[model samples]
Target: MKIVLIGGSTSSMTVAARLRRLHADWEIIVYQKESYVSFGACGLPYYLGKHFDDYQRMLVRSIEDFAKANIQIKPSTKVTKIDPNKKTIYFETSDGQQNTDTYDQLFIGVGAEPVMPKIPGIEAPNVFPFTRLEDAFGLKKLLPKVKKVSIIGSGFIGLETVEALGNLGYEISLIEAQPRLMARVFDQEMTELIDEELSLKNIRVFNNDSLVEIVTDDQGQAIKLKLASGQEVETDAVIMAIGIRPATHFLKNTDLEMINNGALVVDRRGSTNLKDIWSCGDCATSLNRVTGKNDYLALATVARKFAKVVANNMSGLKTQYAGQLQTAIIKVFDLECARTGLSEAEAKAYGYDFKSLIIKDKDRTDYVKHQKPLTLKVIMDKKSQTLIGAQIVGYNSAILRIDALIPLIWSRTKVDNELEQLDLPYAPPFSRPVDIINIALSKLAASLEEG
Candidate 1:
């Protein structure tokens, strides 16, 4: 059996490694557009912030390693098209040479690319996109000489870039078109807390506004930003971290099933509409456990797990992906936030009869040093009495509590006296006798009983 994998993304590489181990005699090859394979793009912001001086650390596996494992990696090769009927793929190499290969099975994991808005003067030399490793290296080299940096968007990458640049003493101005940051993922209540944290860090925020144009100098350097609200802000450089779209343009003309945004649509077996073609990762949509719909969750956690399911199914294991809750966590300065399952707005949007509650408490005992204030929000389905969503915000390790709620939510565990009395460990240095989760669960159970 011959397998050809596209993109050298997390999903492609994971599937390649797993397939090699499962079938040692099978032929596996990976074609990557970039010069390196297994690059962890998630660490790009930390790389720009000088968290580590070695850029090579972002590479998960060296070419030599894959070669030793009997898996062939063709770097700097861009796949142009796939002929499902012929079972062939055409690609262009770095030297402008075209080639074709035949495969019994094909896996597409091209992942996503950063969205570049169509604005005037967007081609300025100082403007950069924050998705690729080259973007990190380019900005890291340029930012030392630049003082003020303007970031467009307030999503995960946008806020993370703000924290990274702010730590390096660069004045950061965050602009979001929505009324609040992370408007899509987090509710307004959670965003308000995030807003407070950004303010305390001295980061300037512009909400309910968007970039109209980049006012650049004669040298093609951005000097100021023209906003939709008739506001102009000066800046030495601009970083566009708005969001990403699936890199599936090359496969548009094919018969493969895709969502409106070009994300490949696959089933529990990670099999696409076309036979012998499988896809997973940011380039594909995964089943949302709570919503029971295919959702584009472009997180590495989803990509890696879904890859395993795809690989096993291809290896005759009949494995299926269990779906995901879109669990995520982020840190901004002294604040840490984590969330899993649906938000309150999401539950409402899905037409779920849910009750929600928020509680504020301390992370540890009063006698414990460095105790910080912790806040928790939980949403439960009234009909089933099951936990549907949870959010946590606080300093130190408070966000880790979300880990406990993830399994419960995944299993749709009902909120009852047994769950309220969950025997979570407690120590003065870590948590109180009754953790914040217990407190929140107890309150939720009481509310359900009263109703």
Candidate 2:
């Protein structure tokens, strides 16, 4: 058997690794647009922060490593087109050359591209988008001369980049078109906490301020960012981190069902509408178990899980993607934030009769030194008392706890049942009189009774 995986991402590498393990005799080939494979793209920010050196360290597997497994790694090769009927792909190699390769089965994991707006002076040298190793290199080359860096979005990439560069003596200004920072995934109360943390780091943030245009200054080098609020500021450079759309342009000619931002539509087994061709990861559609609707959740954690399902099904094994809880976590300075399942706005939009409670609890008992306040909230259906979503923002709460709530939302666990049966460790140093999460949720359950 011969398998070809296109556009190397974490998911693609995972599928390749698993396939090689299961069928060692089979021919496995991976085509990547860049020399890097299995790159932890999320680490790009930290790389710039001087937290680590050595670009090769960012790669999970080298070309030599894959070769040892008999998986042919073709670096700097771009798959331009896919012919599902013919089971062939037209590709371009490093020398600007084109070739054709046939495969018995194919998997596409092209990942995504940073969203860029149609603004003037975008082609200028100073403006960039942080989505690849190339962006990291660009930022490094420009870092020494960076006295001030203006970021255009306040989302994950933007915030990470801001904090990464701020420590390097660069005057950072983060501008957000939304009224609140990280407002899309975070609530206003949580956003305020993030804003306060950023302030402590001496990073300036502008909210509800839209970038109108980018124009070159009189010197013809630096770009001036103009805002819709009739404001303008000169910036040494700009990194656009507004959002990302799936990098599925190559599959446009294919008859695949794509609706949510052109993410490839696939059923439980990762098989697309077309036969024999499969897709997963950031490039494919992600189903939200709570919404019962398809969405695009571009995260490394989900991609890894999806890859396993695709690998098994490709080998004639039955598997399913029960969908995701959209769990996410972020760090800004010393603060940690996490969320699982849906948000209040999402529940209301889904037409669920829901009620939510936001509560504050001490991280530890009064006698505990360095006790800090933590916020926890959960949204649930009033009638069923089922947990639909949960969020937490605090110090040392171990944001991984958010995953513990995923089953509650995905399985529609009753709030009372989970509260009583959930196995939880009791420790004074780690938590208050009652676990912070439990204390807040228990109060939420009580609120339902009064109504």
Candidate 3:
């Protein structure tokens, strides 16, 4: 058996490694468009701050290592087209050379691309979106001598970059078009915590400000920003952490049936609507198990999960994937923010009346000397009393606890069933008698009795 994987990021590398282990005789050829493979794109911010100076440390494995495992690795090579009907793909080598390859099984993990907003002077030099390792290297070379910086977007990457660079003593201002930073994930109260934290970090944040124009300096490097709010900010460098879309435009003219945002439509098992084609990672549509809808939730966990699903069915095994729960956690200073499932607003948008409870509790005993922790809210369906969503903003809070809640929501299990049995570990320095998750559920159980 021979397998051809078009992407070499987290999902494709994970699947290819396993398939090579399971069927050692199978010829597996992995094509990675970038020079690096299996590196943490999430660490781009830290890399910019010079936290890890060695660029070679970012890579997990080299092409020779994969060759040792009997897997053909093609780096700096792009898969130009996928013709499922013909069982072949048109590819482009890094140096502008063209080639074609045939495959028995194909997997695509092409991931997403950072959105470069259509604004005047956006094409100006030094205006950048640091999405890949190469982009990180390009941006890192400029940060050392920079004085002031303007950042667009206040999402995870935006805030993280703000803190990382700000800590390195750069005057930074972060701008977001929404009324609150990370508006899509957290509630109003949760956002307040982020605002306070960012303020303390000396990173100026501007909400409700949309980019109107990118101004350049005499040397043509981007230096000023004009916002929709009639505000002008001057800076030496402008970094765009705005939104992103799937990176499947290479298959644009092909027979792939994609959504409006260019995401290849895939089922829970990562199999596309097109025959003999499977896609995972940030490039494809991920099924929301709770909402029963096809939405794009580009998180690393789902990417690996979907890759396994494709690897399983291709190897002639009976397997099924339970779909995705968009769980995410972000760290800003000492504060931790995590969320999963659907929020209170999301449930109402689905036309379901839900109840949400806001809890303010100590992470540990008042005399225990453990720092204060706050769990913002727990949103649940009133009819079924199930855990629909939760947002936690706490100091030293357990981000993994929110991760544990994802499976509960995905299984459609009731909230009361998991109460008092979270089985979280107990260490005085970390947590108190009952974990915060259990405490919240216990509160919910008491509320049930009160009604």
Give me the displacement of residue 206 in model 2, in angstroms: 1.7
lDDT of 2 by residue, 1-451 (tens): 8999997899999999999888989898999998878998888889989999897788898889889999898999999998888999999999999999999999998898888988777767788898888988988898788688899898887888888888788888898999999887877778899999999999888899988888887655556888899888778998889989999888888887897588898887899888888889999987788777777889998899999999998888899988988888888878889898888878877888987888777777788788877887788887778888888898875555676777778888777635744666666777654675676567766776677
Judge candidate 3 at residue 150 and give its lDDT: 89
Query: Of the pair 2 and 3, which is ahead by TM-score?
Result: 2
Estimated TM-score for each candidate: 0.98, 0.95, 0.93
- Could you tell me which 10 consecutive residues in candidate 3 have the lowest summed lDDT? 411-420
- Can you tell me which runs of candidate 3 are displaced by over 4 Å? 398-400, 417-428, 433-435, 449-451
Candidate 3 local Cα displacement, residue 101, angstroms = 1.5
Which candidate's lDDT is highest? 1
Candidate 3: clashing pairs of residues = none
> 93-197 in candidate 3: lDDT tens per residue?
978999999998888888888999888878876778878887787788787768898899988888888888888899998999999999887888888999999
Regions of candidate 1 where Cα sits further than 4 Å from its true position: none
Candidates 1 and 2, the one with greater TM-score: 1
TM-score of model 3 (CA atoms): 0.93
